[model samples]
Target: MEIRQLEYFVAVAEEGSFTRAAERVHVAQPGVSAQIRRLERELGHDLLDRSGRAVTVTAVGAAVLPLARAALGSVESARRTVEEMAGLVRGAVRVGMVVSCGVMDVPELLAAFHTSFPGVEITLTEANSDELVSSLVDGRLDLALIGYAGPAPDGLAVRVLADEPLVVAVTDADPWRARESVPLDELLERGVICLPPGTGLRGALDEACGTRRPRIAFEVSAPPMVITLARRGLGPAVLAASMVPPDLHAVRITDPVPSGALAFAWRAEGPHSPAARALIGLAENRVTAP
Candidate 1:
């Protein structure tokens, strides 16, 4: 039997419905049935027991199911291998970055990648670290520059670009500006402008808080806004040590100081698109922390 017929048979066996199998294989239901009949004729045996409401595979069908799946998998693997050999010549890469990502120069990296693989189309999206990780898991993103706190995400290949302490920033007019460091309890006592929850920065802050809850004055997605509002004397801002403005007084968090980590990540398992593989290789070769 032809690969198409085998494919249809496998789909039917797995889906247990000719209509659903036809939809999955993008063929008409009648066509799928005809093909399966032809396959059964060639094999000289009935592959499925369709007398019941739910289709069941016959003994011979069960025996051939794994082989059919293996054949399809082999073909797919071969296609991916060839595509990867072509590098980023003809494919799209969906990339993600955390909002206000300043740990590494993402634009510069993208520019370099484009220069090298001019044929590859690149798309960029911005979101929180947690959202980015979720997108990666769901196959919506090919790669991401995400901020993570605590442990790295499960089933993701992570290359850390930056890991630094979280600091509290205040204006010169603030009473605690002269202090060398601030405790988590003391920092939470004042109005704090920080990154919203569901972000790596927020995770770190929350971990540091432990049982205590901080009064968040303003929850912003943009990192620069945190410093801007604090500098305006609105409230104290919590941000990465490196993100703290040069003019603002940055106080280290003394008790259980939280730290934010920025990383480049992709799916640890599964086949990567050609452009995704190329970009990942390029990033690995030329990752310099800012």
Candidate 2:
């Protein structure tokens, strides 16, 4: 029968009372009963046993109930799909970034997207690269600016934005300032202030050190804090070269300089909301910009 008739039939089957089903579907009891009767006639079966005080589904009705529900669900899903396509850039896009993003201009990129699609809401979050990658993988984040020590995280589509050497920061008073670069071992000898584990920089550092545990003086998330500590001579701060303060001497890691790779990543083969797609397009445009 018709979709409306099927809706009435399903409501009656679920509610077990014509009056209650009518109320649930916001239709008059007589109208609901008439529709169900029409549906039964069309299907050529006694769909409901209405002889008793409470209505009950017949054998045929029982078999048809699940199919009817599936039909309704499919219709609703199709309606939503059409609505989403029509309302481009209407939903929210959750974007993540590392604590210190030196490669991509997040604000500039977001501003451009917002300007193009004012209807789209851009929600920004800052976390370490590892955490950002995890969020993206779990669908908590639609897109992200993540840092990687080597290749990008698996199961994600990545566009490398920038690649730069990791450096050790020190104040002018520090003896290491005289040298242009220092070996990783020498830098770690005094004390190393680094981002905590589960971060891109720390991952790179861990990979480089390889079996040799460096003395970690302090673990902080903010790159500026690393510079602050290094300036105070608390320890040499391991940081992305771009993040090093201008006043601080940035010593390149000589023995196998660990490079920080920044990239834009998103789910490889998942359904991306219109807003998410719009933002991704903007990011791609930014990547190609001179």
Candidate 3:
């Protein structure tokens, strides 16, 4: 019922033991147990099953955990918002991005942010688009620079930052290296190295290839690994135009003109903290100007 009680309950649910949860929350074991008992009493339901040494959440507990988490997150966001209103400008921004952003835009953007808002801490998480979207929905990320393919998620704001062409990179020894522009159909017949289906680049490539399924010779999760596979002459790797490594020859895909748009996304209805707003403004300015 209380925020502290919910915190204790969540800690116990996560740690699976009162003693461990107490240690994590920096409270005594008996105190933690008492809090959980009080919370269960208030709700008139048994939240945890403590029949064995390993504690487990009851059905009621499982049902309420997500709501408790959301409530706690809302509280924290409110506190941070208040702090930002005082012009303190000291808070953390969690950003979710794809690997290409790390290679192409992250360094410059981070450097500029650090210079402009030294008091603000920036945390970066790189993953496939699916993971990024999941994080964004869970309130784990403040903003995300993700590949835009289909419609944006409901109740989220999306701003298209850049449009990057998808290029086929092959090793110097490969037969396609001498070509100026490869036909989309011919490229589809040749094997292509790609990330797994959940990756943003993979989705864009799949959409672009249309009916002719490209022969995928390698499936790698890391961008560098895909580039390495291409460098080894295994197969041509599909990557954003900006991610082309210097050692590999980047061949433009022409027929259908395969390209992907990058966009920044954030929760649409929530109170925007000053630091978040500043980062969003900086991102839009950087992407739009010059």
Candidate 4:
């Protein structure tokens, strides 16, 4: 029969009174009664016991009640599914990235997502890895690309783009340049150029060094700047192996070498918008570690 007939029948069966069911369904009492009557006629069974003041359900109506509710639930679920997809046509997604998080091309990922969902707005934030992770945990960002060491932060779902060791990037004039790797003792003899404390590369270095503070000759946020200063022979720059310039020797740090990783993170339990979900799907294809 008609879906409306089923809806009216279910409403009356629950309310136990045609008057209350009409108010609940926003239909006139006569219309509610007529539809339920039609539904019963189709089934050739008395769906309600009108003899009772409370409008008790007939044996047939008792069995059909549960089935009618299930049908309504399925319809509502389908309607919601369509609305969620339609929502992707226009929405916004917030993204955060570490400074010089060049392990993956974030702009390229966003470009692809935009191409697919042109109406979706995107907001970008540039911060150190520590801050990016914090924003993700705080629900301020939908997704993030970051450089990190050791395990990922708790409560985030991560996709590791690249995992490699930290290195001592030194100019040829530096004595350590000739070596494939240098121990912490030799590397610590002088101040080293490094990213600021909040960065992942710096965090990795700090973890490796422990209580003995490594001398900081230069503290810069950008990896390119770290490379530029190291090229000028300021001091050895501690950087991820992948970020070391070809002009400089990438001497792996020894005496417990620290590793770094480039990764994408999102909330493990997400209230992700359709647009955000679409962007995450495109990120897998657009971002690749060198």
lDDT of each: 0.88, 0.86, 0.82, 0.87
Error of 2 at 32 (Å): 26
Please, what are the lDDT tens digits per residue for candidate 1 over residues 1-290? 78899899999999999999999999999999999999999999999999999998999999989999999989889987886767668878999998887667888999998998888889999998889999999999999998888889988998888898998898889888899998887888887899998888998898888888989999988988888899899988999898887889998997778997889999999688778988998887776654
* Regions of model 3 farther than 4 Å from truth: 1-83, 87-90, 100-104, 111-121, 150-154
- Badly placed stretches (over 4 Å) of model 1 are 1-82, 288-290
Task: Estimate the lDDT of model 3.
Answer: 0.82
Residue 29 local lDDT, model 2: 95
How far out, in Å, is residue 204 in model 3? 0.9
lDDT of 4 by residue, 1-290 (tens): 88888898888888899999999999999999988888889999999999978998999999998999999989999998888778777788999998877668789888878887788889999999889888988889999998777888888888889888899899999988779988988888989999998788888888888898899989987989999999999999999988887899999889899887788888888888888788777776665654
Model 3, position 97, has a per-residue lDDT of: 86
- lDDT comparison, 2 vs 3, better candidate: 2
TM-score of each: 0.71, 0.69, 0.62, 0.86
**Clashing residue pairs found in predicted model 1:** none
Report the error of model 4 at residue 61, Å. Answer: 3.3
RMSD of 3: 14.4
Instruction: Estimate the TM-score for candidate 4.
Output: 0.86
Worst 10 residues of 1 by lDDT: 281-290
Residue 175 alpha-carbon offset, candidate 1, angstroms: 0.7
